[model samples]
Target: MTAVVEKIHRGRKFDQVLQGARTVFLRDGYERASVDDIAREAGVSKATLYAYFPDKRLLFLEIALTECTRQTEQAAAEVEDDRPAREVLLEAAQKIAEFKLSDFGLQMYRIAVSEAEKFPQIGRAFYETGPQAGCGLLCNYLRQAVDRGELVIEDLDLAANQFVELCKAGLFNERLLGVDRKTTAKAIEKTAKAAVEMFMARYGAKVDA
Candidate 1:
């Protein structure tokens, strides 16, 4: 009982540190965010912060991975195996596009991109945890769809990447460039539909009634 309580306490402390790191990283970016700031934000001592996260980069990676896992799980949960390929693909695209354009997503992306040149590991971590994980989930869904005769994907991996890129369409670039950031549901739906249409044009299998 004592051991379990201690374990739970440690878990809570870990989470507290992560929450603090996330706030600091978001506000100051990776380059400017300091361990001291994160410790203060977390309401923990510097020693406690260091005990949980040895370095700032590892702390940042943990935060990124946690967020990525959350987003990936949310997207994956929305995929219905019994649904038609078009519907599933459209839903996935809409979720991806919406998340990419969201404020939190945009901020996280900016931090990753800004630090990528100086810290390549950060970029790699972001890619592996974010896009790569997302692509992998989509690829699995596509493979299942193919087996179910819903899609005819020759290269599941490539198709997954292309489908996601299609979903981004004009939204991601525009948001990244500061040209447009106010994405509406209508726009997201339209992008999803267009992506599904184009993707189905190439890989969708014809079904008999």
Candidate 2:
């Protein structure tokens, strides 16, 4: 019982540290964020921060993973079994598109791209946790749609990637390059609808009369 209580306390402290680290990293970016700042933000001593996270890279990786996993899960949860494939896909796409355009997402993306050459692991981690995870979720949903005769996709993986890529068309690059940051909800909906329409045209199963 004592050990369990101690473990709970440790976990709480770890979460506290992570929350603090997240604030500093997002506010300062990966290159500018410092351990001292993280410690101050977390309201913990440098020793305590180091105790939870061995170094800045590992800490940043954890933060990135948390954000990516959260977004992936949120998108996946939008896929309902009873909803029409087009509706489900469009809804999921809108959510994902919005997330990709969010300030946090943009900052993390910039951090990953900027640090990719110096810290390839960070880039890999972000890809695995963010885009790859999102793709996997969509693939799983597509397979289910195929099973239900809603889609005629022979290559689930390719279709999944294509659908998401279609939804992100024009928006991701524009936002990433700072050419367009104020993308409205209507634009996102239009993009998602277009993506769904294109995907349905290619792979949607024809209904029997």
Return the TM-score for each candidate structure.
0.79, 0.82
Clashing pairs in 1: none
Clashes of each: 0, 0
Candidate 1 lDDT (Cα, 0 to 1): 0.81
Cα lDDT, model 2, residue 23 = 95
Once fitted onto the true fold, the runs of candidate 2 whose alpha carbons sit more than 4 angstroms away are 1-12, 26-37, 54-57
- Write down the RMSD of all candidates, one decimal each: 5.6, 5.2
Tens digits of lDDT, candidate 2, 1-209: 11111112245578788899899977887778899999999999988887767777667666777888887877667668788888888888888788888777877777677777886766777888888999999999999999999999998889888987898799888988889967888888899899889999999998779
- lDDT (tens digit, per residue) of candidate 1 on 1-209: 11111112345587788888888887886778888899999999998987766677567666766788898988788777998888788778888898888766877787678878887767877888899999999999999999988888888899999998899899888888889857888988999899999999999887679
lDDT of 1 at 97: 90
